[model samples]
Target: MNFKDYIRVIPDFPKPGIRFKDITTLLKNGPAYQAAIEAMKQQVAELEIDVIAGPEARGFVIGAPLALALGVGFVPIRKSGKLPGETVEADYDLEYGKDKLAVHKDAIAPGQKVLIADDLLATGGTIETTVKLIQKLGGEVVGAAFLIELSYLQGRSKLGSVPVRSLVTF
Candidate 1:
């Protein structure tokens, strides 16, 4: 299926001159949502991942099912205070300052291979921090996958050598 056809483009979303690719429409459609997750699963099927880690909110929507499909576990990478018990955090730069992301302190075992998945790849700041959090716990980031990527933002540049794949690009 052409997954892009399921996405809704919202003009000037959250700010002027921004065309937001909303996935809610796609999520509402059963076949398209499954198609997206299946597409992502196929992309990373070759990567031997011990765990699937994804940042909060949208990432949960995509990662959970993908993890189940792969017969692996899904780790939640959330904002500070969202996760109970001991947690580790990595800070990322924002337009003005920075924000932090937290993952369970023991979310990944040392040397475990991790695959990061999300609904969209935007500025890459979050994904970069996510990669750091995984590394801090000694997990190797095998790949980062997304359902959509706003390539014009040049987010991929911030990811350095980490392999990134997106099913839909705009």
Candidate 2:
């Protein structure tokens, strides 16, 4: 399936001179959504992933299904105060703004291999920070997966040597 067909492009969304690639359209289509997960799953097939970690909101939407497909646990990296119990937090800047993310201190155990998932990769700040959160809790970040990646933004560079897989790039 052509994943891009299901993605809607909105001009100047949430601000001017920004084209937002909305995944809600693709997510609403069952076949398209499944196909996307399959593609991402294929990409991560070679990685030794113990669990899938994703930042709050969109990450939850994408990571949960992927985790189910991989028969592994899903760890949610939420906003600063979204999770209960001990948590590790990271503050970062985005393409359009700045934000923070947090994950439960026990979300993953020491030496656990984690694969981060998300709807989009723009500035890479969120994913990078998420990796920090995972590592702080003793989890090892093996790789990252995304549905859409704005390559021109050079998000991958921010990810260092960590492997990053994306279904579509623009």
Candidate 3:
């Protein structure tokens, strides 16, 4: 399937001089949704992940189903104060401001392999910070996955040596 066609291109979304690839169009189409998960699943087939951790919002949309497809648990790395009970948090700098993410104290057991998933990988700061939180909780980050990756931004460099997989790039 040409997943690219399912993604709508919106000019200057959330800002000027930026083209946002909107996934909502794909989400509304069942075939595109399944194709995306299958493609991502194939990319991470060799990772041997024990759990899939996705950031809040868009992450939940993709991560949950991917986790289910992979037959693994899904852990949510949410915005600060979103998770209940004891949580570990990491602060990261965005292009315009700083933001924090938190995960449950027991999101991952020590040594358990985790794959971080998100809708897009731009600067990689958000996902890298997610890995930090996973590490803080003693989880081994085996890899990271994404639906779309903006290659021009060089986000993969921020991810260090961990394996990073993506279904499509723009």
- Residue-level lDDT of model 2, residues 1-170, one tens digit each, is 88889999999997899999999999899999998999899999999999999887899999999999999999999888888888888898865687889888888999999999999999888898998888888998999999999999998998898999999998
lDDT tens digits, residue span 1-170, model 3: 88888889999988999999999999999988999999999999988899999998899999999999999999999999887789989999977799999999988999999999989999888898998999999999999899999999999998899898888789
lDDT of 1 by residue, 1-170 (tens): 99989999999987998888999999999989988899899999899989999998899999999999899999999998899979999888888897889999888999999999999998888998999999999999999999999998888998899999899999
Model 3 root mean square deviation, Cα atoms: 0.8
- Model 2: clashing residue pairs? none
Error of 1 at 146 (Å): 0.2
Against the reference, the lDDT scores of all candidates come to 0.92, 0.92, 0.92
lDDT score of model 1? 0.92
Per-model TM values vs. the true structure? 0.97, 0.96, 0.97
Better of 1 and 2 by TM-score: 1
Alpha carbon deviation, residue 57, candidate 3 (Å): 1.0
In Å, residue 19's CA in model 1 sits off its true spot by: 0.4
> Could you tell which candidate, 2 or 3, scores higher by TM-score?
3
